[model samples]
Target: MMFENTLAFARKLDAEDPLKNYREQFYIPQQNGKEVIYFCGNSLGLQPKSVRKLVEEELEKWQNLAVEGHFTGDNPWFTYHKQFKEPVARLVGALPHEVIVMNNLTTNLHLMLVSFYQPSGKRIKIITEKGAFPSDQYALESQVRYHGHNPDEVIIELAPREGECTLRTEDIISTIEQHSQELALVMMGGLNYYTGQVFDMQAITDAGHKAGAYVGFDLAHAAGNIMLDLHAWQVDFAVWCTYKYLNSSPGGVAGAFIHEKHAANTQLPRFAGWWGHREEERFQMKKGFIPIYGADGWQLANAPILLMAAHKAALAIFDEVGMEAVSRKSKKLTGYLEYMLKSNPVMEKRIQIITPENPAERGSQLSLLVKEGGKQLFEAISAAGVIADWREPNAIRVAPAPLYNSFEEVFRFHEILSGHLR
Candidate 1:
């Protein structure tokens, strides 16, 4: 499909977009009485209009029902997390019992590591991307130390070849095979946050299993932005935050997935908590910890009702629209952004799209590496009301979220950016 770099053409696409009406459901940021061209959903998604009412309902329950809110309210706090099991499972392609809405991303990562990052006898090393999100790096390092091993020796960080922006699938597979004997775990971000590259998770999981290692992904960026199949791919475990593309509020409750094979193993080691105890025996309050079946077994505490309410609101949209439609619009929306950027002769010469061009290898984001004036260019865009993200060293990342962002907005961004170039 040919794309034209004009406002009329952009509006034409928007007019035909099936997902255009969904944009009205979100509150786009305002700048000087006008809506800014928001492309920062990858960092923090816009709030859903339904969030206020849902959150207030929880607050009302707390205010009126008091202690009885746990057992008597419309949405009982005791079973709030259970409501997300089906929708969240559908979002990530997992069995209903295999998913849980829980603590923040890093916390869930630590909890998963406690169970899956077992280093025994000769198998001690963990394989991960070199520039994984800082939290993941810290978590892996601390986990290795907790196991009485040196991180430098027990962790293998994969890097791209010279001058390459992303890791190749072959290189990743080869590295896993090369250290197959000692590799105990293979943990990586499902999508690179900085470069916007989507890794081949299925292939990676297969390779890890072949090498006698447990494989998992930190799906902070990939969860809502791309399609995933944790169960079908046989991923041992995975975790992600809802504040990004999921459009839950800031630092909202995150999600986790454990394969049925791992989740059903109630004896699996974990940092046991009372909430994770079996429901039938929970009130009995026995001495021994008998974990509830599936991913809920890893829960360290009870639900944060307010946060989960926000999450419930967000997931309803995903449930209504479905990830299949979201991903389909994402390809066309992001592709058009790339085309519009490249259409600018000045931008073509001065900026580089470091993200993979293939639609399958990326999501909504396109990381622009400005050949010169990187910071200044980012500042210029920001001043002009473009809500994009800036990474250190040299990159401006923009993600046109399919759920809310429109083609007209992407075209407007191009116009603003081209003006700055001129």
Candidate 2:
């Protein structure tokens, strides 16, 4: 891919892109009444233009069918969620029954924890990474208390070794091995939200099983950003939100995966609701919670149709452009971003690229460790019309999504950011 100038790299890539046309499907944001270089898709993704039609279809069905909308809508309110099964399953590499569209990410995480994190006396500890998203940390804390266990005592948070930006695979496996008897669950993020370091799920799963512990992940950053095979990896369960790399909008619907091995066992205790009951027996006003098989049984309420429609729109593009293709482009796009950042004098020495250098170990997002004028730098970048995220003290997250973000936008970010350097 030859380019005449730095800004032309994006044009060349776009010309060769198979899924380039899908970029037009979204509603891009404007800063000065012109489209800004949008590199924040890892935080809140751009919206799909087809969302209105999808929502309107539901609206029409609601007004016409009224009470009958449950079974009569274009997609049908009753099984609107089911229409998404195949696409969602394909995204995470799972069987249809192993996945379900429902609730928000944090809510689904709590629900999954209820069924999967069953701790007993002595074997009551949970193993997770330090500085996980606050919601996951909170849920795990409350869950531990709910089980009459102390989170501080029961939750073992693994930290990176001195001077290391990310956790080592060996350290995680060793932690599981050392705590095998005491550790009941290895619940952690599939990718660190701050570092953009993707965990070795297969290795983690193998180690957890060896320790007689169940392994699961919060795939909020990993879901659409990386390729995963939950079943093949031997992961017991996983949860993810659609709003990030999935491009489904903020607080969008979430989904989960429960391995087939656990699907048939009725022994797993769940915090269930009427919606989780079998379809045939649900209308009987069932007495006992006759749970639906697999991941569907994790649901705790009626499906949110509007939210699911947004997810459906996002999944359509994902299905059209397979993860293999998406991930391949992602590596080059992100590698270019890293290359540009490193080329800068101060940013290279002062700011750290916390994300793994290996393309296979990361996604679209790069977490930059800004220094000195960190807050000022983040605010300056945003004012310059480059949409990036600032996390707490000194990190800025910039993701150039393959579907919509351009390499030219990345050059503009460099131009904007370089001007602010000392």
Clash number for model 2?
A: 0
Mark the regions of model 2 whose C-alpha exceeds 4 Å error after superposition. Answer: 1-5
- Screening candidate 2 with a backbone cut-off below 3 angstroms (N, C-alpha, C), the clashing residue pairs are none
Q: Model 1: clashing residue pairs?
A: none
Alpha-carbon TM-score of each model against the true structure = 0.99, 0.97
- Model 1 quality (TM-score): 0.99
Q: Tens digit of lDDT per residue, candidate 2, span 1-422?
A: 32333766656766777767777888889988988888888888999898878877877777888879987736778777788788888899899999998888888888888888899877899999999999889999999999998899999999999989899999999999999888899999999999999999999999999899889999999998999999899899999999989988789988889999988777888888888888788888958887888888777787888787777888898898999989988987888788888878867766888999988899998999976778998888788898888898789998999888767777778888888885
Best by TM-score: 1
